[model samples]
Target: MTWPKKYGGQERSFLDRYVVTEEFRVANAPVRAHFTADRQSGPVLLKYAADEIKKDVLPRITRGECCFCIGMSEPNSGSDLFAASTKATKTDEGWRVNGTKLWTSNAHHADYMIGLFRTSPSTEENHRHGLTNFLVDITLPGISISPVHNMAGLHEFNEVVFDDCLVPNNHVLGEINGAWKQATSELAYERSGPERFLETFYILTEMVRTLGTEPDNRSAEGIGRLVAQAHTLRRMSVSVNGMLQAGMEPVLEGAIVKDMGTVWEQALPRKARDLTAFTDIGNRTNFDRLLRYAIHIAPKLTIQGGTTEVLRSIIARGLGLR
Candidate 1:
């Protein structure tokens, strides 16, 4: 929602976008078709892409007709993004990309991928200096996607391979081999969003439904603590959105929000299960099913956007403790 008005975005305040995002998440809306583009890719294009690229992509994104997948982690990379070895060699026509991106979400259905690839050799003095960001057309030749299902038997994740895939010079985002400068700012957008905490919100809703208005002391206390935690996280997330709107990179604040939010969300299923242990078995069958699915999906929450350990390190560095 931060794109310019000319680009078909409403140019709404970040807080307005925050409200919309929270409403969608709480309602369990099927937003996966446009979530990545709306949340991170659109802002990235606005800030870094050329006018032509923005003109071509932003409107489609705003129309919810395009899907984007991030290509940051590789087989050996994961949270250590600097360890990525996917290569993009300069060619007479444009650039030739060859590598495999592991654990890329929605790659199978993505219209585009904002890929990070190695463009030069990393020196000992600056290991992060050699990477570049390219907006790859997923339908291009030499690009292949294979499904990598999660524990829930869902096929949302994938492995994408590039073999001499051609990326035009104009498709390069920001400066060549200077993507590191653009990365942290992008992550500030990615990590501070309401999605971090709201993924498991269904479990909390189910818990409340099963408990009804009047509850025992333990159940009430558990519900109160969960609600309080959710409120605190929403406050933190909204504050970061304000910072983003003000044109400041609140990397530390974003990291803290994601770190805490993801941990809480990852544990929410178990917490809800415990809180509803004494609920009438007859009324809890649906709750039990939702809780089971949440449990299955919980492990990936902390590891997806960024791992807990990596986020803690970022927060520590921001606090001058690392």
Candidate 2:
């Protein structure tokens, strides 16, 4: 909704996008197919890509014909993107990439990847330098994807390897060695979303349905608290979106939203287990299966996008706490 009309966008407001996103998330729609493109990738290209690239790619994304994935978080680097060692050497033709990206969600299904590769060594005085963003066609030669099943036995994550993969010079997004500026601003789009807090929302709805209209004091109180927290998160997330709509980068606000939202969502299953322990909600809508799935997937929520520790460090530095 934020894109211009010529790029195939409706030019709708951010609040309009937020409402649709919230509904799809709560209804558990199969949005992963285009979620990355709709959320951050399209916006990234809109901001950093050349006019020709945007004209070619953004409309495809708007038409739901393209998918995108992030290419950060290498082995040993974890959330420390500055420490990434993935090399992208400049060649006579274009660029050759050689590295492995771990925990890449939806790489197997992606048409393109907004990958970060080190084009030069980091200087001692400025370690954030030398990293560059590239629009990688994952289906290109020398690029391969391997599935990394989660604890829930889901193939949502994959490991992507770049073995002398050639990327055109035009695919080099923004500055060659100045990706640090871009990455921080991109977080505002990545982290401030309803999905950050609503992944396991079904469990809560089932809990309420199981308890019926007249829950006991304990159950009612717990549900009330959870509802309040969810409401607060929604407000914070909406405010961040508003900031983005106004062309301001809400980096710190976005980090805080993800940190709090992920923590709350991660703990939801445990709390549901404790609160519903005495109830006989087993046969109602496969609560047992849903709970098991939530529990299994909960561990990775905080680690995705950005880890809790990394988020807190950003929050700290933003607030002058460091």
Candidate 3:
């Protein structure tokens, strides 16, 4: 509730917001209803969108009445956002977008999408140039959404195709052909959130419960290590949030938190599985089921937001190694 008085928010500090996010993740709250909007899209709009657009969208977002999806990754350009082929051509009516976006989470249910489209052709000297961000209304005509089921048997992702979808000029999100500048700052918000490290946390919690107060040395050691890792990542995430609140873009720090956090989260399920292997809990079926589900969904932890390889490259560039 703490956003800002102007945007229908409570104007809470980043630290306060971090507390809410951590509580939600630890409890496995069903926040999918408004997760993306609250986490990244709302802030992006507040920072770079037109005033009218902000007045239209920010209130609804704060009310949890609107959902948003990002439209950056295409079939041809997953990590290399500069290679996006989705074209947004200038028109008297506005910008007409025509292209496909893959792995668009919640596109099937999202009320809006913050899309990155090619506004001009990339020059050899600047491959990252020529991209533009748009606030696309998913209800607009000529847009098609098809489901992409994951290994977990969930239809949480979709392939969104835009065929001459018209967006008003007022919906343009920042400077035309300069979205790359805006993108890095936005990604820092995404990469450093608690979700980066907490996706598979339920499995660890369940294992601890199954192990009970008295655990073997091996089980105790495994649980201790997992707790330590989770605590360290939480500290890193909070530190990044502090940087963001100070109006500084800690892209390198965000990338490092995401890189290390996702790696640990992806490996957490397997580690929990091993820890629970020799457990003698008589009625631990629930724990077993959750562990299985965690294992199924664990593979995507490092792939989403940004892939491990992409995050490492950003970190390297920030460190002056690239």
Candidate 4:
């Protein structure tokens, strides 16, 4: 997929291609459209960065030469996003980053990483201050990446260690330590994507297949509910994308979609657990394995980018909070 020059481009989104149920389009189509460039790490490079980064990153993605990953979370930090311990110190050479990042998807294969770190200490509340972002190279000498075996025993994630890694002065994103503002924008991008909820969607497609010629009430009802839910969530997701395109931060709505969509993905297996025997161990528990995958991965959906609790905090504040 060629990367878009501007995130919220005037051209129709990439997701316009899929023939999804109309409802899904309303809830989350934009997310599906910008899953890669718009949703993940693309924005920081686009918004806070200079033109050179864009020039290199854009065509590289179009040519399939660039891969991306999130660099947040560690053994101890999960829900307390602001509590991350990774430190990036300013040095004459640039910034020397040293710390470990956990559950980093695509870490093993990605060419660049958008890392979260403490550039200084908080001046305001502990939540505010000292945080920053950097576009780091995985091939740098001080970096080490190892895969983390998952539920299906799949090597999809990795543990990334940065040992005094060097990031040139230009690599610093936004201000010296003003990432909190930047993070608000980045989280909106991360939380609004389709990947959060579509990881195990193949099961639903399989259910439609297993029903064969005519699905009974249970099968039809089950599939219909999922299809409808996917539609609704998708529409909401698309709206978020539209908002992002407008250069507005739809953080609260994005949280709502991720929290709700992930819940629905988790529910898919439970709703179909008894509808089919294909869930046998040999079949990867079509339900059991997917259920396992969704469950294990589900927590990360909320935790990744930002925690569900943190999202609620944001939402609650929107309702009325100090």
lDDT of 2 by residue, 1-322 (tens): 7789999999998879988999998998999989999988898899999999999999999999999998988996877888888899999999999989999999989999999999999999999999999999888999989999987888988999889999999999999999998887878878988899999898899888777788899999989998999899989999999998898988999999999999999999899888888888447548878899899999989988899999999999999998
Residue 310 local lDDT, model 3:
93
- Overlapping backbone residue pairs in candidate 4 total 19
Which runs of model 2 end up more than 4 angstroms from their true locations? none
What does candidate 4's lDDT look like per residue over 1-322, in tens digits? 2135453233444344222323343343333322444345665676776678777675665455677787877878767666778889988888898889998876876888888888887766556677888888789889999999876666767999989888878877788677777767667656766665675576676666656657777777777888999888878877786787777888888888777877777666656555664423234445455455544654444455566677778888877774
The pairs that clash in candidate 2 are none
Give model 1's TM-score versus the native structure. 0.97
**In candidate 1, what are the lDDT values of residues 110-136, reduced to their tens digit?**
999999999998888988889998898
| Lowest lDDT block of 10, candidate 1 | 276-285
The sequence of per-residue lDDT tens digits that candidate 3 reaches over residues 268-291 is: 989988888888667898998888
Clashing pairs for predicted structure model 3, backbone only: 2-10, 3-10, 3-11
What lDDT score belongs to each candidate, Candidate 1 first?
0.90, 0.91, 0.90, 0.69
RMSD to native, candidate 3: 1.1
Candidate 3 stretches with Cα past 4 Å from truth are none
In terms of lDDT, model 2 sits at: 0.91
Error of 4 at 236 (Å): 2.0
